[model samples]
Target: EAEVAQSPRYKITEKSQAVAFWCDPISGHATLYWYRQILGQGPELLVQFQDESVVDDSQLPKDRFSAERLKGVDSTLKIQPAELGDSAMYLCASAGALNTEAFFGQGTRLTVV
Candidate 1:
């Protein structure tokens, strides 16, 4: 029973600075997703990838946020010039395929002041 790996469980950054989170899903999972969860709210999808190709990222702020899975294994989510509204938990999840049971990471909590 492997698990998803996330780095820097907590982060604090001044507004307008750059921050990034990394995730490595369980081996052999083909679908990876990035999500943002505000306090008291459920996670919201930020990006989805299938084998190195982006499947969806409509909810992602293109100007400030970006996500990528170079080899379809590990992924990164980055925010440049972070804002106060960007403070939240960044979560990474993976599933064997779409609509399957997904496994989640511990999540990276970001705070922007």
Candidate 2:
């Protein structure tokens, strides 16, 4: 079965430090997403990837956040100089290459001090 894969179920970093999260989307999928969920809020789409190409990243805070799907498959999200306000759940989701069912992985909860 297809499943989204995420690592380091949790992360703690001091303010102004850098951190990165990794994800491996279900094989054969071509659409990937990176979402950030604030406490109690719905997940906000941060970036969307269609294969190795970025289709949407308008909501992504470009100043500090960066993501890439180098091989058009697995992906990575990085935050430079993480901020206390950057603390949140980073969720990786994937849909079919043609936009079908999407699945979420247990996220990486970031805590910035």
How do the residues 32-113 of candidate 2 rate in per-residue lDDT, one tens digit apiece? Answer: 9999999999999999999999999999999999999999999999999899999999999998855578899999999999
Q: Write the per-residue lDDT of candidate 1 for residues 29-66, one digit (tens) a residue.
A: 99999999999999999999998999999999999999
How far off is residue 53 in model 2, in Å?
0.5
Top TM-score hit: 1
Per-model TM against the reference: 0.97, 0.96
**TM-score of predicted structure 1:** 0.97
Cand. 2 Cα-lDDT: 0.94
lDDT score, candidate 1, position 76: 94
Query: What's the residue-level lDDT of 64 in candidate 1?
Result: 95
Alpha-carbon runs more than 4 Å astray in model 2: none
